[model samples]
Target: MSPRSASVNEELRRRSRERLLQATVELVGERGYEATTLADVADRAGAARGLVSYYFPGKRQLVQSAVHRLMHLTLAAALDREPRTDDGDERLARAIDAVLGLTRTHTTVMRTHMALILQHEGFIQCPEQQKLAALLEDTIARWGAADPGQDYRLLRALLMGAVVALLLPGAPMPLSSLRAELFQRYGLAWESGCPPNDEPPPRS
Candidate 1:
């Protein structure tokens, strides 16, 4: 193929992949992973079932792609608004706050992610999960280094468990309050504690 034609073909492939990922996200978010099928995703994306199969061989692959896409979107949002600080503790605190905001802003995505991660053995085995876990472990390591007594792995578990708990049906606490409490419990200052107008401004 000519270089221009090859470029166009690659672009088309990229767009098709993005559409498939988008459909996976929407259907999985609405129906949960177990209830969503490749056929459903193909219908939602207006693509042939064969196209989805061509891109992702199985339901597990589609769900894994969806989860990875969701995580990327969530983390991108959080990182865009992340606070700048040199101190390890301060950076960790800001990260916690950012993650909480992400969870609140993307509740459906978060729920879908958690549901997939916990209930689907395939998801647990996916490479994307390993990448996410490593990122999280690195974040916790930064905080744990600041406080030698803190267990990084344990802290990660607590934060993940806390998100799940807060998302539970009939949970008593409001998201905002729960967020604040979680940060404070980890010895981080709440945004409310900042001086008037001194809170880190939102990112553009």
Candidate 2:
């Protein structure tokens, strides 16, 4: 058989990286942050252990990138959900709900991710994070922000605060409340974007 072409090799490399990222998400979600190791991620990914080191500088960076990828995929899905609308209000609502939803469903993974970000490492400007930023910035622009650049930072700050509230240990806040606050800030209707049931998110 002929040797693999450059494009084929690139595709294979991409797949390996993606597999490792996905595996990290799954393992960390299952076993918590401290318990899950890069070796475990490699095993779950069915890739060589060394491949994890190649794709990520360390386990910390690996988990962060994995979570970012998960967030990007999730926000993308929400944006593309059926009955998609061009209305900025609707799109922004979906974007907010999509991220807040992750805090609820992927609580463990997200909690670990948020905690890591708080440490000295801070935000790692990986490809996955850049994708997330682009989606949010575009969403803010669509919402008719006076300045997307400024609004994007503001929206990001709000969402980060909401996630921290949702994941706070022993005293977690309600997602509904966070969602309501975001909707109010964005001038969105209560019924928009994967709205919660009749019961509202409790106020602190």
By lDDT, the best candidate is: 2
Each prediction's Cα lDDT score? Answer: 0.63, 0.91
Write down the TM-score of every candidate. 0.64, 0.94
Candidate 2 similarity to native, TM-score: 0.94
**Residue pairs in clash, model 1:** none
How well is each residue in 44-136 modelled by candidate 2, as lDDT tens digits? 999889999888999899999999999999999999999978899999999999999998789999999999999856899999999999999
Model 1's TM-score against the true structure: 0.64
**Superposed model 2: Cα runs more than 4 Å off:** 1-4, 201-204
Error of 2 at 121 (Å): 2.4
Q: Write the per-residue lDDT of candidate 1 for residues 1-204, one digit (tens) a residue.
A: 999999999999888888888898788667777788888988898889899989777876677776666564554444345354445455556555555554555667667666766876635445455655555555656655554335655666666776786677676345555555556666666553221242333322
Q: After superposition, how far is residue 100 of candidate 1 from its true place, in Å?
A: 3.3
Scanning candidate 2 in windows of ten residues, the lowest lDDT window is 195-204
